[model samples]
Each structure stands twice: as C-alpha cells, then as structure tokens.
Target: MHATPLTFIGASVSWGKLRSAVTTWQPLGVVSTISVRAPFLNTIRLSSSIHHTEETDVAAIDLDEANLILDILHRFQEELGAISDAGDRLKQSRSPEVDEYRRRLVNVKGELKNAAKSGTLDGVKRPQTELERCFYGPAVQHAAAHFRLRTDAPPSMWLSGLYDPAGDVSYYTHGLRKLVDEGQII
Candidate 1:
C-alpha cells in the first residue's frame, strides 16, 4: 500500500507565569499543527455494488475493523500522553540522568502531537522506518484476524479482496515479499 507523507507546521504555547506574594506558577498551553496528505487519491472506499451480496457480514466486518483501528489510535495517544507526562515529571525533578531523556521525550512528544493534529495517525502517513511500520502491523493484523484471514495477509485482502484483484494479488503480495526480503517484515 502507498503511504502518505506528513509535514509539521508549528507549535505554540500560551499562558503566563503568575506571581503572588510568596509563590509563582505558570500554566502552559501547547498547540501544535501539522498537515496530512494521502498517497491514495481516496481516503476511504467501500464496495457498494457487492454490499447486497453480503451486506450484513461485510458491514459487521467493517465495523469491527473500524473499532479496532480506533482502539489502536487510542492506545497510541495514551502512550504519547504517558511519554509527555514522564518528561514533564523528569523536568520538574531536575534529575541529571533524566535530562537527556527528558529532551528526547519532549521532542518526540511534540512531533507526535504535530502528527496527530495533521491527521497522520488516521493512517494517512506511511511510517518512515521499518520499525515503525512493523509497530503498527499488529493492529492491521488484528483487523485481518477478525475477518478470519492470516495475520500476514495483505490489508486489501481483508478489506476488498475481490474488487481490487491487482492490489490484493500483486502490489500487496509483492510489497510483503519485498519487506520480508529486506528484513522489514519478520
């Protein structure tokens, strides 16, 4: 499958420090923006013509897949939040060893938020590294498994197997093979 690219725009923080007779505090507001582009012309596709052939089953499968994707996205978001929280705590503690970790975490968190704002997490952007791609493979495979297909089955096979013969048989199969050959898939 073709993957889209994501571009980060900018980030901003709002709010000012408040000082009282004996204490000072600041509440920060961070806003990040990004743009998500799809490699495919269409973001979503449905086989309407064949719906009548197996409407109920197909609809159920689609719903299950959608829910699975949503769960994965939620988990990803939670992971990012945990990373950000950990960084914030480390920064507050002022620990020497955590200094480097904090910086890296903050940077990664920012990038992730920017990507999310840009809708990249919606499956628009293809992962830049094989590791990242593999990280998300389980989620894809979960959806496929719900459809009673092999975990390594091409995504198109689980989605619209008959309609996109070329995609299911050639592009996806070849892509998987290439990934395996290059050690991108394990």
Candidate 2:
C-alpha cells in the first residue's frame, strides 16, 4: 500500500481542522488529492477524487457587525444590574431593560439569519467560539440567578450563579479598543 503524502504550500492550515480531517481518513485511492488555499487559511479537505477549487471569501467581521454584537452583550450587563430595581416584579415584566434585552436578542438573531440567508456569513464571521462562550456562559449564569431571585429561592440555590457578563465584553473589547486606540480601525 502506497501512501501519498500531502504537502501544503502557499498557505497555512488551521491545526484544529487538520486534526479533525486526518482522524476521519479513508484510503479512497492510491493517489490522494488535497486542496490548499492561500490567505485566510481555513481547513484542509482530503479526497480521493479530483476536487474543484474556488476563491475563498474572506472570513472577517466588519466594524458594524462587531459593534452590534458588542452592543447586545453590553445590554446584557444593564439587564443584570437592574434585576434588583423591581425586586417584586416578575421576570417577564421586571424592568424595561428586560424588554430591551429581548429586543436586542431578536435584533442579533435577525442579523445572523439575514447574513446566512444572503450567503454572506463568510463576510461577517463572528468572534471565535471561545470568546463567544465567555459572554454566553456568564449570560446563562446571570439568567439563572435572575430566575432564582424572582422565585424567592434561597441564596444558596444560586450561590454559584452570579457571573458578570461584562467581564467577557470588556475582555473582548479590550483587543478591539487597542486596535482603535492605535488608529488601526479608523
């Protein structure tokens, strides 16, 4: 059995994607074909048959898209802060912030949906998943805490549920802030 070692040239490959591709390897034929792209190196696709190559659309987030996502995250912080303003109010109507929170949620969902529908998601790639989880994890915790507070549950019930979403917002924004601070994003 002869193995055709693949060589990547003119571009770099993401290790995570490379690892996943190699793990699912199958010997389709004696001669294996590999596709490599330049610039925004995404992944490597291994196949036994010849494959067509296409120009890769750059996976980048525009300033407007980045700001919209950041705005939603910032609103999450405001909602958490006002949870106590109407201590007696139900979670559904506790504060106007909740309504605004829901609105922002819908707004983001819409933006993503529209982007996908237009085949433009490649152009608006959101931040990396790890960074996204930073915001999402805390948001979930804060929501749980808010629910517990509304239900009059004992503090111990959600002792570990108090997470500040702004931590992630600031963490992510810090990088962007630096870029702008240095006149990089003007």
Best by TM-score: 2
Find the 10 residues in a row with the least total lDDT in model 1: 38-47
Write candidate 1's Cα lDDT for 1-186 as tens digits: 433222211222122232111211112222222121111121212111111122222211222223223333343334334433444454345456455544444443333333333232233443432222332344333322222323233322323321222122233234444544565422
**TM-scores of the models, in the order given:** 0.25, 0.31
Clashing pairs in 2: none
**Candidate 2: residue 41 lDDT (0-100):** 21
lDDT of model 2, residue 34: 37
The best candidate by lDDT is 2
